[model samples]
Target: MILIAESGSTKCDWVLLDTLNDKRINTKTKGLNPAILKKKEFKNIISDNETLSEYKKEIKKIYFFGAGCNTSKTKNNVHSVLNSFFKNSTSIVEEDTMAAVYATTSTPAVVCILGTGSNCCYYDGKSIINKSISLGYIVMDEGSGNHFGKELLKAYYNYQMPQNLRALFESKYDLSEKTVIKKLYQSKTPNKYLASFAPFVFDNKEHSFMETLINDVINLFIKNHILQYTDELKTVPLHFVGSIAFHGQNYISNQLKKQGLNAGKFIQKPIDSLIEFIKKENAVLQS
Candidate 1:
């Protein structure tokens, strides 16, 4: 058996492959970003999952691609935790961008992630060239869920959000300054907390204010992340992976066109495609 995981800062998707019977068992857990989560928390998440715990020994290999696993230090943190949990398995850890590349396209293209966080990488069909280093959600992650969340919060607090929308927002969430401050400053996963508000924006996306807001966020993302791969964009389509991209496809596509860039597929969940990609790689290796 083999286990493959695709994780963002918000959640982790797991697929257990029974190679002998050609069966797949899927399960999920909260995000396991080694950069954000403690070592004990990582162990607890896996141990608490009945499916993973039951199949721990059965899994001989684990391929974990996740956010915050870009650097060697963060990668090894996740690698060590997986090794400890799945005592019988050898784990391979890589950045989430690689999973985005595998799931989105095989040819040379620029892949971007717009989930809890945002990142862009240019894959030349051989190697991933990241032009900018992700400083995480606090300083970076433009055009992402957390980015949109921040925008909405700012608009509401500054009396910039329209009265109708502000009323709706206030009704739905506890936007007390005290509560918001505690969540942002004292929470373990502040990025995820901020991203939690993104759904409200999506829910009200048809509104004029939301339309303008979405455009601004997408424009910034294009200018900052996609444009960095200017040379690559001219030749290859720009691919996207994550919930924000999936939901905001029309807005993203329009913005890409304005920038004279081609748009590729928008994958809401990359776990299934990622598994297919891994299967092909393994088959070729065995062949």
Candidate 2:
């Protein structure tokens, strides 16, 4: 058996693949990002996952694809926590971007993550060979949940938002831009706070301004990040993952095709491909 984890900035998806039977049981736990999660949150997630102790003991390997584990320092921190619990198992840690590649065919393609945060890479199959900017939450993370939320708040404060949408925002958050600013600037885990408004975008999909807002952000991500990976303007099959990619796929994919980039498959979560990968790989090991 193999244990797998795919973590974004906000949460993680876990699966225990019983290689022997080719069955995968799914579970979800808290986020595990070095940049976003403190030691307590990280420890908590590990504890809850280890609650599957029967599976934990039976599992032979653990593969983690975690966001914000970009540096050796970050990777080691998450590794330390995971290793403590899965002591009998082997653990492999890689950045969340690589997980997207693994979620895809592990081929030479553009693998993107559009979620709480957005980032892109040109996966040469063997490795994610190169990646574009993930300039943190402030300047980048375009085409992300937080990005959508930020736009929603902007429209609300600027009075450009439609009345119905504005009312929803008022009802949900009940905070003015000034209050939001104070909270965002003065709070901890500000990214989570920013992402809080993302639901409003979906709730207000009928509003033209919301469409424009979504389009602008998705376009910026394609132009800045995806385009940067284009090799001599040759179109590459771009695969997308995460909730933002799932929800805003039409707008995001159209914008990419408009620029002559071939938009390929979009998978909301890596769990399916990950299970398949482990099952297939484990078969070879057994044989």
lDDT of 2 by residue, 78-183 (tens): 7777777777788888998888887787557878888888888877657766555466888888888888878877777788888877776788885866878777
Clashing pairs in 2: none
Model 1, residue pairs in steric clash: none
Q: Work out the TM-score per prediction.
A: 0.98, 0.91
TM-score for candidate 1, residues paired by index:
0.98
Candidate 2 all-Cα RMSD: 2.2
- Candidate 1 clash figure, as a count: 0
Write model 1 residue lDDT over 1-287, tens digit each, in one string: 98999999899999999977999999999998999988899889989999999999999999999998988998888988999999999999999999999999999999999999999999999989999988889899999999999999999999999999999999999999999999999999989989999999889999999999999999999998899999877788889999999999999999888988878899999999999998988888878
Q: Once model 2 is optimally superposed onto the true structure by TM-score, how far is the C-alpha of residue 108 displaced, in angstroms?
A: 0.7
